[model samples]
Target: MIHLRSLQRLTLAQRRRTATGLRAGTILLAAVAATLSRAPAARAAPEPVKVVVVANFENGADQGDAPGEFQFWVEREHLDHPVALRGAPDVLRRGRDGLYGMVLRHGVTDLAAFILDPRFDLRRTYWLFTGISGVDPRSASVGSAAWARWVVDGDELREIDDRTVPAGWPYGLWAIGADAPNRLPSDPNHFGSVTELSQLSKAFPLNAGLARWAFDLTKDVPISDDDAIRRARAAWNGFPAAQRPPFVLMGETLGSRRYWHGEPRTRWAEDWVRLWTGGRGVFVMTNMESQTNQEVMRTFGRQGLVDPDRIMVLRTASNFSEPPPGVPVTASIGDEGPGQRLAFDSNERVGAPVVRELLAHWTRYRDAIPGRP
Candidate 1:
């Protein structure tokens, strides 16, 4: 009886050992399978294709004001590739300001979204922003279109009261001249001083075909009518020192009131321009009346949308300069009215030629630059 009981106990112990081995094997197999399943998912995603984004313009005449208006027209009329319109979100969110935020809000919600969204190919896309900017009174006249070399936030400068306190500003007109060799140092408040694609032949290389196309398209378009020039010069002659708007005052005031105090504006301008030019661009606008241009351009640069070499700034005349003591005074011609109206319309009419040139240039640039497409 005792031998039989011991035999039974040994048999039970063997069974228990077998069961323990089986359970251990099962657990080990499950862990190995789980690890293998995650391997593919852990791989990094591919880079997204570059895309140009144009947002709806906030101000100006609705007809020619929106960035997308010109961008869509140009893509349809000029580019051979697909151009997609990004939707604008209504909810105002924080952490997005200037042109970067505008592109994010209106075109693509985020850069990552642009990368992951099935609609866009990660490896083959790019973007550009196209729109009109107010000409600096000192340098460029009304009706002239310019490409940015650099975009600086006018509000980033120091200010006092409602005026921009210029003592330690990082991106004032003076700083612009110090950076760009082609720019003249005379007028600091003017937008024309910003470096443009036309001027930066080396660092921000221009596609010769593109430059030729831009020149050809814009060449025939009259920059100024004789009558308009006469009127502008006449208006300047008439304005007295006390009545004339000061250029420095314009920059200072714009920096203090509009850009510094409020939610950052001007992201659309920066993003679109940066995308179109492949990352190097600049902007020009009145410091006092419209920092929108400056703010937007600056935002694009900061966002990595633009290539660093392709940046510059330019300004026209300073509205801040006081006229001579005895000059006759007339109402300011700064506003875009009847005379400026024709300039915007002319873009639509002559845009075909410009489109042709742009396409040709883009093709040539793609060919010249090894990795661009």
Candidate 2:
């Protein structure tokens, strides 16, 4: 009988040779097919056409409005053309994880073409991201829409050296705006890169109306009474002067245990918003959970994926600080849910105008952007 060891060696060698021969033959066949197929060389894959929508649980106080508004604008209006709107897989929520899976499912890589192929769009299509974010109470008011010069996955995080310095030590990955005029000037040790959308912004500044509409919708909403806003500011004030982070970072999706403090996972679902809408803009709104303001902006400043000039972050103040001693604090902000009208009726009225504005912006910006379909 043949020795077992010798037999094994012979089998392995034969497998390797067969594999090599198969590869060679495959290449030969491909060459022949290419010649026979057509006179012109095969064209590169079409450029990826995508957009992103964020359903923040912040400002609107109800998650319902965010998703509902996105569906109406993206599916009903913008996507009325021949393009397709791909649905992302449902996120897995369990254990200590909250929105962690949601973020990975929606991060830059999980986006349409990125999920399919980083170079999915070589020539056609576009990607867009829409959603809500919190604005600095000092700088922005409730319902006002603002665009990001850069969008930092405020929640998605990595480790950093737990050391303090005069200049500030940097550690972590931040996606900056592709079209941002200047790179973030903070820490030099952090990981930063301009995103694909940022490049598109340079060619086209994105529809200005989307930002305008967000402003219109929330412009009148009272921010003085919201509890979240009151508490967030208080939290900021509570921080020691030396420990306070420079910029305010706010997003509903960031506070969840899943992303801000979780393991490596796919943020694919969130990426769907990008695939459906050609990259146009990024929206920052509010959510139920309160998060560290400095942390939020630091994340954005680090990434540089969004254009800071175009960034719109809108926040409705839920609560204002009470006056001390004999002073009385009046309720300056409006209620969270549907204001005066019935919930359904109010949503339709308030949301319709916003949608219309978005469509108008899309038409103007889409046509203006270079390399856009």
Candidate 3:
């Protein structure tokens, strides 16, 4: 019934509509494909830790065992969450409070690994290194605690046989590039031909202001004391500091792998710390691991994994570095007696307050470090 021209015009209109529909479908498919391609892959953010309590070792289990450097912290802090460290058997425990405690055994390597672990975001975490040290009687009595400004390494020295050292030289240990004992090396970068010690000096300085802040904050905390330590303190006659009851002080720590004991060695530690710190530091405590740990921390800091200025070293006196008058070095070397318990107690009492304060003021402290203007 219709004309041929009208039928042809209708077919052309239908073709144009079909073409528009296909073009629109193609544009929508392209957009959807592009959106799918540009979508981000799923990823997890790193875990945040505000405070890390770095303890050297623990006596036994993490809980319900004889207390070690980590026990009182774990027990008192209620650090019940056990997070297994990747590639290591050790566990990093956490508390409901923003505190993390780990007892490191393989000193530097373990610490370095912990810091480099991708699982933790430690950029703002503060490190509190707490341990018992052989207390210098001249610095403090047993059970006393010291906030350290410097951790001087007693290792990394050239040693000749003490019996063969030149006359008047106190001990065999001397700087790597120095000619005599108690002397500084002209160039810190070179550690002889055999050992390349780099420019990292033996003196590992902590934030002086922070150390003072901690000392002032807890100086009045009642340090635990016992009759055995009291009686032992009496043996240190003529040494005024040793004779006094346990109290907090600001002092430096001398760390050496060798557990050297005796009056002569004590004198060496004193001189060594003074020598390394340019006489600005005095040796008050002796330990086996501070230097290694601090050195690792410094490296991590440089790597942007941590803030080195936030590090604090707190040493409680478990025993005297040297024997008391009339006691043989061999006899008193390993006799911590009641001083160990007192030191443990002091560590908790003195350290807990700082931890609590940090937690309470995290809103402010999270951005601004304490003792900084």
Per-model TM-score versus the true fold: 0.40, 0.32, 0.85
The residue-by-residue lDDT of candidate 2 on 215-310, one tens digit each, is: 445445322223432333343333232122222222222222232211111122122112222333232323322232222222233333222232
Native-structure RMSD, model 3: 18.9
* CA lDDT scores, all candidates in order: 0.30, 0.28, 0.76
lDDT value, residue 15 of candidate 2: 21
Q: Who wins the TM-score comparison?
A: 3
Please list the residue runs of candidate 2 whose C-alpha ends up more than 4 Å from where it truly belongs after superposition.
1-106, 112-126, 152-367, 370-373
Candidate 2 has its poorest 10 consecutive residues by lDDT at 27-36
Candidate 3: list runs displaced more than 4 Å: 1-41, 187-189, 192-200
Residue 95 error, candidate 2, Å? 36
What's the distance in Å from true for residue 173, model 3? 1.6
- For candidate 3, which ten residues in a row score worst on lDDT? 27-36
For 190-233, candidate 3 gives per-residue lDDT tens digits of 63343344453689889998889889899999877788778867
Better-scoring candidate (lDDT), 2 or 3: 3
- Local error of candidate 3 at 204, Å? 0.8
